[model samples]
Target: MMRSIFSAIIFLVLTRVVYAIDPRWGQGCTYIDRTEQIYCFGGEPFSENSQQILVYALNITGNSVLDLSEPQWTDIPGDPNGIRPSAASRFTFTGFPGTDTFYIQGGIVCTSCNYNSGFKYSVSSNQWNQTNKNKPVVDASSALVNDILYSFGGQTSPLTGYDQSNTTYRNTVYYINAKTGADGPSVKPQNETQLPPFTWASSMVYSYVYRSLFIFGGKQLSATEVTASMSDITVVSPQTGVYSKWKNIRSTSGSLPPARWGHSTIIDSSNRTVVMFGGCNDSGKAMNDLWLFNLDDAVWSPQETTGTPPTPRCRHSVVVLGKYMLVLFGGNDGTFNSDINVALDMTTWKWTNAPTNILPSDSSPPIDFPNSSSPQGSEGINEGGDSSSNISGGAIAGIVIGSIVGEDSSSLCLRNETDI
Candidate 1:
């Protein structure tokens, strides 16, 4: 009897220890150079099935995703009222010089949300602060650009539930200063910018690859009513002043992503290709077709991706880490905690056969820093033709040079999953 009791106690202790060290995907991951870490936010529950552990990586260097090592969960709670928000949305994690952390912009605390609200997270302190502004009620569209957060569409009232096929839109753009010091003076949102009533077709399906944010395709922006007549790419550059102008990239191609708002997009950095998968059609019909966008050329080319893209999903959480773009865990797709992480390898153009839960050791070649020198003392390209300003090393790391002049693909994946 004494031996059995001792053995049982040992097993229980081991189990608890392993649970504490489980590899948490977190809501999603971000870079925390100030902390000398890579931080990942937890995915939110649009419903009960959407909850997951939020995590952070402390020992990262260079551009290798492997730098994140494995993720460890932070001791944070998802209670909507909790100071450390586990769930997140359109919040921008902008880092500044002299500090090794990123500031969370505006986002909704949807741990138990029926709609949306305002909240922010701090990486250094692992804290979330309730903002002064209660966001304008909009169900589907919101994004963070620069120091401001913007919500584009969705109706606040007469809505008790969420419908991925929702087309009702507020088309109002709300902005907030995200860089305000944590304990510094109070900040105010600039004037609200409103646009024409839009269809919320893209809300359910979209990705944030590239930079300066762009929406590839979607229906009318309003809910309560749905429209499938429009399918054009709309872009909003945070750099634009006053009101960020929405530029329409009209497409003449007969091929588009089938008027979607909930499908997700992933940037294949290795190939400069945009992969979009799963969303309902304009008429409340769920779809599972996969599409690819050539951001370099501003063109959408459809691809027949294999190995089971989740069955007709919308409102799913996808993230880019290492060389694999992991697509797993989302709802309105028959089940949640689907417990599957699909790894798509860009170099091989094939999916790997492994438990999504089990990923290989992360790896990526370091940037060729020494090769960074300009051609033997010759100044690089100038504004006119004279000696140009020297481009700093940090500038080179974030620089995207190619045919793509649009959103950050990784940002698109996070934005779509931002409500998490």
Candidate 2:
């Protein structure tokens, strides 16, 4: 009986000692399979005006294979000679498969101020270089298919005269060569064919198997009023230098999630389905529900998950590691910024919080309130949609910086930016 109790205590201690560290929510993050590493960069941290790049090396299991471990966050230094992007939120990061390069584009630098320029980072070199000189309009939804990056439905706010009432939303679609950062010839909208309504903060994912880019809910704003949420799903296919006319998939069966913006969606290539979670509704309330859309059958179904879920939030990052696990980190739970990390198993639909001791020390100062709009919102637009035009401008000031929250005793070598 004594031996059983002792063994139980040991098991609990081991399980609790390796918790995943938390990052400031609203940053852009993506997993690079080539290095078995996850890179997160740029976002508003609490009370600070600058943002930094952060990296995490996933723990591996037996046989030299890549496996998920509680991620230990590390601060990656900026390149002295490289063009570092200003700290901001609502930017898009797309990883180019088979290469160590990822692209960042179209985020706001301040309330009502947006960046159209794009930059590329080489994981192997740990440096940043300007991509296409032709800036993409900010707040656009993008996806990387084949070697091309496609952007759709963003708004442009002028630097000087930026005002929420004067912002312009677009239905035009643009493409850029992912490898060379040059503009691909634009495809004109099909004649007499209507496109998806002008929207921003929509989520998009590209499925290689189906060769289609799927776009989900976003908000549409007009001079007179605001459409806080949209339910239409638009599909576009890119071929050679052209794109197919947008097709709206109207669900004939199963229930659709409430139309909301700032939710995160990821493609489960193994299961051939898209999973979505957490965003704010038209009422500006944060959500915690999980929803799944089957690409094969074109059906949307809510997923009932087991285990303690992260608090409801929006603007967080979610990435698929390997075939079945989804890693979700950061976001604001309406009132406070959240630094929680949680994962969902696709096969069994179970949620697991990465263990605890590996978490950053609570002694660190409390994070500052996020002062930027949803990377998709205009100067006065809330990160999550709110019907009232009475938006808070106080939270749209200073930039947020990311830092290593805890000590890492592991022997992993810190590579210099030049040596990357």
Q: Best-fitting candidate, measured by lDDT?
A: 2
TM-scores of all predicted structures = 0.54, 0.68
- Candidate 2: tens digits of C-alpha lDDT, residues 72-166: 45455556566765555666567654466777766665443335367887765667788765543555666655556666666655531233335
What stretches of model 1 exceed 4 Å from their correct place? Answer: 1-75, 78-117, 136-151, 158-168, 181-196, 201-212, 218-224, 227-230, 237-254, 266-273, 283-285, 295-298, 306-308, 333-339, 353-420
lDDT of 1 by residue, 1-420 (tens): 563454344333322221122222113334333443334444344335454444433333233333112322233333444554324533323333234334443234454433333345554444556554433233344333333334344443323223343323344333445455322222221223322345342432112222334444444534444543224444443323112222332333565556755455544422234466665565545565655554334445555455645445554434433444545434443334343335455434445433232222224431121111121111111112222211121211110000011222111111111120
Which residue ranges in model 2 land beyond 4 Å of their true spot?
Answer: 1-23, 45-71, 110-116, 158-166, 191-193, 222-231, 240-255, 270-272, 333-339, 355-420
lDDT value for candidate 1? 0.37
Q: Note the clash tally of each candidate.
A: 49, 13
lDDT agreement with native, every candidate: 0.37, 0.51
